[model samples]
Target: MTTSLAPDPAPDPGLDPAPDPALARELRRERAHHDACRAALARMAEDVAEQVVTGEDVAASGADAEVLGRHLRSRAKEFGEQPPGPLFFGRLDREDGQSHHIGRRRIAEHPAEPPLVVDWRAPVSRAYYQAGAHDPQGVVRRRRFGWAPYSAGDTADLTGLEDEHLVSGEDVVSAIVAGEIERPRVGPMRDIAATIQPEQDDLVRSGPGTSVCVQGAPGTGKTAVGLHRAAYLLYTHPQRVRRSGLLVLGPNRTFLSYISEVLPALGETGIRQSTLDEEIARHEVRAVDGEAAARVKHDVRMAEVLRRALYARVALPDGELALADGPLRLRLPAEVLAGIVAAVREEAPPYATGRERVRARVVRALQLRAERRAGPLGGAWARRVERARPVSAFVDACWPRTTPEEVLAAVLADPDDPLLTAGERAAIRWAKPPRSFRSARWSAADLVLLDEVAGLIERPESYGHVVVDEAQDLSPMQCRAISRRADFGALTVLGDLAQGTTPWAARDWREQLAHLGKPEAEIVPLTTGYRVPAAIVDLANRLLPELGLGADVPAGVSLRRDGEVRLCRVADVATGVVEAVKGALAREGSVGVIAADEHVGPLTSALEAGGLLRAGGDGGAGGAEATGGTADVVAPESAGERLSVLPARMAKGLEYDHVVVAEPAAIVAAEPRGLHRLYVVLTRAVSRLDVVHGEPLPDYLAS
Candidate 1:
């Protein structure tokens, strides 16, 4: 199409010459551009919402991309234009009619090839912080801090206060107690460019608030805010909040490692972190039980010796069983049986008698060999031997009256005793006995909130600000523990109600927490997400619920236009893996592979052994060792291959730049808990997202 050429209009000398004609023309052009940009923004918002609702990733549409570029271009011109008259439109109609273009170039031309249409304003943009506060005054404010410094004695110095001796004089004691105060620990603060959404700030800063239940959507910075609040508490109420008094209950070891540095970065410390399982096990076994529990080992070696020598062909090899048969053969007195039972009840590792002990060893040796072949039935046989009655009433009475020495002799003399079942062979094979593995000692450290943790929270020296990040994953049991010990400090709990990973326990944690007397809690809801591209977030919100995951968050969380969500179909399961691997590499995404347990082994093997993918756990490409860097596997051992290739049950509260859900078909057959996990995996993507497998995409995503 030919462009129209118009002759320039001459300036009038009679009009007020204060405003230059060229400047006026530029203002007029900027206004037209600004109005167009605004309309494009409004349209982009509407389009994103519609696509999200209709189950489409916003980045998949071309018009959405064009609009984003135009909006940016228009905004830049409006702000940079010298004569800013058009920007200060006097009437609402004129301003409303102006078009807003975001691109740096002219709207009439096509955006540069491979157009950058990312809406920096969208919470999902990587450049979000660069957008900064809209107020020009705030942008130029001087920065007063730098990165935090690390010190070796930081933890030790704080803990050393316990060793101090107090002065006894009345005047001196009063002065020391009243006037002596520790120096405040101030850390460097990064310039937060993105304006903290006004509503979010209000929710976080409200006073002595109720137990704040912040149901944050994924990518919404729940953990970041929780840490920030702790820093804020330390700043505002230094007396009420201290570093040592704070405790954090996380989901697992990985999460603990993931958020370990946040508090320190904010110039605070003393936040205790641990998993729920470790805390519970330790508390129940040690402080609660008050007994040193060890594995029970029975004493009956002598019985096995006699049984083997007397009836080697017919005797059962289970030594514990043969030992039980010892009592039957001996016809031990009831009083004597009671003695052995009493010794067992006392949990004596080594029984008292030396003579009987030798016999018990022989019996144990034979039974151990037999049990290896007979399996768990060995224990059952031993119980039967102990319970059997004597052949006659007088015999029983006589047995109960017998001494340990007498019982031993009686058992040795009668090897073919009634306790030996027919067709059972007594075989005594002397081999090395299996040593019982000691039960792992779980730590009571994280159990600071548990009632049994003596002086944990009640102490005046504890941490002052406690934050429970990912609070939704915490169970009532966990919350109880957190409340008791954490009560000594201010509490900040953040999580998304929709993505409660531990619903089995947390289903009632809310009520349980209320009963614990934390009724006036601040419940903050973050409706916007600034992590994933808007397209990715929109897809997640729309389809996540269909998969029985996440809360009903608004589409604003992912209202951006620069990221794409695509589904790649593979010719077969194996081919699917290759496609996923290729696509992930092509995008330079830190790839994540998620599958069912059944598929984890094969998929992981194929990816690692076949040299198609790296072999590591949850972090990123560098996770894999130097086997060959074609793919860097980022998997941790405790997390297992399932963490990298398995379903969502293992992937909750985690994210990756690119997530490859390998076997979608398996998700449908998964249990409710498993299904929830699958949903978690699907939604944990940032930029490029795709699902590949023989199975179907989650119903929500498909819908």
Candidate 2:
């Protein structure tokens, strides 16, 4: 069935060209020779299929493997790499009188017009070979079906392709491959090492590397490609890679929810997904048994401050006070108490002064007073005070209580409190503030709360892969905890060194990464950014170095559109935010506005008035509550209703159709590490990006 279309050649003009009749006959002979080769190819396919099904080695028997190998090697030699799709076919005379080997194809490059070489052994292969050949002049002609862009139908057919046809990129490679047809390129391929890029696809298909790092720039389809690659690996090598071996780590739980449906869409089960931080939190809070490395390191503390604060607010009375059940009545009201405490002990030494000393004194005083005044009036007041104690203790526990009031008084007395050492001040700074100890105790409690939270990491079998997104923002200690959870599978860390700020340790994350494994660790760097348009990325790159920082935005960024990177100052923050909102909504649909902190009251109002945003729950800066509301262009109340207006700190590893960076000037002026933080926010947009400033950004960003 092969079609031939050879244009008529110019007739010879020379009178001596007497063999016009003879040349035509010779051309006919050449066509017949090609036809015989095609028939022989079909016979070879039949023999190959029989041996394949019999489980006998095809190469061990007759010319089956030889004939096919010659055809493929010839094509590979000429074409540099064979085009994917029934390279050979086999025909079988079974009881039903027909036999089939599954259809197989390749997704590779082809230079110029390519020839078809079909074998007739397998049913699908025979379809190509059975198309037949033509005696058109001296040249042979046939049509070889080539793979096109994956359409919905092709994606459907993928599920039915034979396993052998689903070879890995590594399995089929051509350093000098040539093809006129342009190949579709996507994903984070460039970030990986060059030695591996040409073959990574192959490795992915085979599933050999213990760890694979897909270091993708913003919007480079890192997540999209990773998801599809995971599916591809599973489908191609069903026995080697499975949903169980694959794990996709996003930035947070909500992120996990966002991409949860990709795999099922591709007709494959979705792989495991979770946040790196929560996984670490779960490990520390639920399994920690041994004491942390530093029981009390001022700055290098290994404690969950947020978790501890929450526990002190609701579960304990007088966060700093410790007592046994015999004296528990002094700590809680009968109604407010969850249950009678059997016993309690001091885990850490009593605090040095202020609330710590006061709380300890009250615990003892209340025990004595309550024991003596066992009657009605005294009992009622004690109960009320105890009930009020938890709330009072909660407020106090959140602020500094360890500071000697006199010392703080001295420090505050002077605008320049340089005399106080940073360590001593920090120690006092994080301690719980003073609480009313009429019923609440003042002493700092044992480190038991922290201990309870640290026990979560006792075992590591619960996870598959541990991937840390936005890793450059992480502290070394946080990185260590993340490494501990990789026991179930391998570890893949993604980060941009330019966004890091640790002067001493952050300077060399690669060295710190060595702590996780050998020097040859699977590390990859994503240079190209697909998030912002070329224009934005170029502007950012040009402006970043002017801040006097050596890190320029990577050159790989492409600003595909003409736009502005102007700094506008408003009469006030509100006015500036309003302008920013107008710019963000110009694109319509959903937009995201990230702030510097969780306190988004001012920005929220401006966005609402502009009819650009909706709000979600109040989960503080790093909490889970995304204030839910409608983002109707007409009435924007909640974050859900309006464009996404969030703090800049919370925008890591996220994207939006459009992004408006609110208050860059205040962020640069106020944050201790604003330069790096600001850059991170600016890179969150996949296409359109805006930075709203009430004042000019630091010279670095503005320049």
Report the C-alpha lDDT of model 1 over 12-44, residue by residue, as the tens digit.
111222434554454344445445544543454
Name the top lDDT candidate.
1
Model 1 regions lying over 4 Å from their true place: 1-195, 203-210, 278-463, 503-516, 544-556, 614-647
Q: Against the true structure, what is each candidate's TM-score?
A: 0.46, 0.47
lDDT, residue 482, model 1 = 57
Kindly give the stretch of ten consecutive residues in candidate 1 with the minimal lDDT sum: 157-166
Which segments of candidate 2 are over 4 A away from where they belong? 1-207, 212-217, 225-229, 236-245, 280-459, 462-464, 500-505, 542-555, 559-566, 586-589, 611-632, 635-642
Q: What local lDDT score does residue 201 receive in model 2, on the 0 to 100 scale? A: 35
Candidate 1: C-alpha RMSD to true structure equals 26.4
Quote the lDDT for 346 in model 1.
42
The TM-score measured for candidate 1 stands at 0.46
**Candidate 2 residue-wise lDDT at 202:** 32
What lDDT does the true structure give each of the candidates? 0.42, 0.40
